[model samples]
Target: MRKILHVDMDAFYASVEQRDDPSLRGRPVVVAWRGARSVVCAASYEARVFGVRSAMPAVRAERLCPDAVFVPPDFTRYKAVSRQVRAIFLRHTDLVEPLSLDEAYLDVTEPKIPSPSATATAQAIRAQIREETALTASAGVAPNKFIAKIASDWNKPDGMFVVRPSQVEAFLTPLPVAKIPGVGKVMEKKLAELGVATVGDLRAFSAEELQLRFGTFGRRLHLRARGIDERPVQPDQPVQSISAEDTFERDLQLYEFEGDIRRLAEKTWLATRRTQRVGRTVVLKLKTAQFRILTRSFTPEVPPASLEELTSIALSLRDRIDLPPSTRYRLVGVGVSGFRERGEADGQGSLFDDGERSPDSTGRPESL
Candidate 1:
């Protein structure tokens, strides 16, 4: 069994504020910039007690937790701490896959450390992070990403959970369908209507039957219900598609989405460049207030030569929305795919020249 560990920092931004400032300790803390449009970047366990949450409007968070101390987000500081955490992870294994600034997945099937087992390796990593960073992290050790991610969250604020290979089914069976990754509220309600409230209940339906009802996602649901995920912990994986998205506090019509789209595109652009890769396509993703998801993409004869072209293509894609003009959207995302190694791709080439594409490929995706 491959040993995978998921490490997630507890209340990363708020915890950082608390660690740096003693007075902020024990008091509910929120990370945000002050403004009508500002959103809470993070909330401490203390603040969460009062229903404060990340991505809530700062004004709303303040009203919910009046006693909460607010600190502006310091991404520089967080990035530095993240580097330290990554260094700790590397000491054990090079197969680390970072999910974000505050979380990563490490494959330690053959650990470099003197630790005797996967569980021991996780314990050691968590201990070193706490000792060095003065911050708590939660970790989960399991056979795959699906189980490991869920196990990591089983305990919060500096804890560790483990699921041995033999216990995979037992660990997954009793969980609510909502606990399955990708089964958001909407999917949960649909599953509930089918009496598939738990992973066990979901498993009762044949994979073909579920697929007929849910399309491609039906297969994913079938596999995840059995605690099976074959994704690996790939270190320094090549960047293919870079994207950014946001969920608005209030849904907005298409015209009102222009500013948000541009902002998200800029973020995606910056991220894409950070990978030192070039991309040839722009993709726009949208989710309606009712939870319907749609995506539009364009691959220019020439890759977008500049940010101006990127933004223009993204905005034009919005024009293709055949839905009613009144359709309001709660979320939008912008991405660049069909990435090429720097100076490697020419206008005549395609991203799939490698013979076949892996499901995990982030390169130009096929249009639905």
Candidate 2:
């Protein structure tokens, strides 16, 4: 059996800010740009007590914790810290899959440095991180990735949990169905209607029955209920797509979408720079006030050479919408896909196409 460890930093961005400035310690801290459209990137444990969370509107975060300290993100500093954490993981095992700057999955089944157990490996890694970076991390050691991820979150802020192969089922049974990776509010409600509220309850349904309802995801649910996840810790996974989106506090007319589209386009473009791959397609996603999603995509004759070119192509896609001028939208997104290594030759393709549709239970466009 493969041994997996999920290590997650405690309130990563906010913790970094606090560690650098002692005065900010023990106070509610929110990491975000202060603006109407800005979203919270991270929140300290103190801020979380007031319901502040990442991806929440910065304005709402402020409203939730009026005394919360707001700090703008510093990617350069965060990346440096991430490198240090990754180096520490390499000391124990080379099989490391980073989920973000704050968390990663490590396969320490045959660790570089011998340890008594996988749990011991995790404990040592956490200790090394604390000593090297002065940051606290929580770890979950399990037979596979999914359970490890869930276990890592069991105790917040600096804790560890271990699940032996023999203990996997017992460890997952009492947990809510929401603990399943893709079981969001909508899916959880659907499962509840079927008298399936917990992982234990989910076991009563056959795999075929779940597949009939949720397609491929249903099969995944069946396995997850039994604490089975066969996915390996793949190091250096390539970027398939990058996108940025926002839901407006109030619905917006299509004509009024320019500012938001431009903003999201810029954000998406900046994010793409982190990867060495070049994208050939630019996608524009829109959601109606009633939650109907539509997407438009374009594959340029040449990959967008600069941000201005990308933003122009994204903005021009607006003219292709056939909706009435009276239509209002609740969300807008800008994305790039069809990634290829740098210097790849461009392939001939249609300039425009109606993007494929696959709406998840939450009635939102499914991520690629």
Clashing pairs in 1: 338-364
lDDT for model 1, on a 0 to 1 scale? 0.84
Winning candidate number (lDDT): 2
The numbered model that scores best in TM-score is 1
For candidate 1, write residues 32-57 as lDDT tens digits: 98655566888999999999977677
Each model's lDDT comes to 0.84, 0.88
Measured against the true structure, the TM-scores of the candidates, in listed sequence, are 0.82, 0.81
Which portions of model 1 show Cα errors greater than 4 Å? 243-276, 285-296, 300-302, 321-334, 342-368
What's the residue-level lDDT of 317 in candidate 1? 86
> Residue by residue across 1-368, what tens digits does model 2's lDDT show?
99999999999889999999999999999999997756688899999999998867688899999999999988788778888988999999999988878889999999999899998999999999999999999999999999999989988779999999999989989999999988877788899999999999999999999999999999999999999899999998788788998888788998797989899999999999999999999999887765567889899889888989889989998888888999998889999999999998889866665743323322211111
- TM-score between model 2 and native: 0.81
Question: Can you tell me which runs of candidate 2 are displaced by over 4 Å?
Answer: 244-252, 257-281, 285-332, 340-368
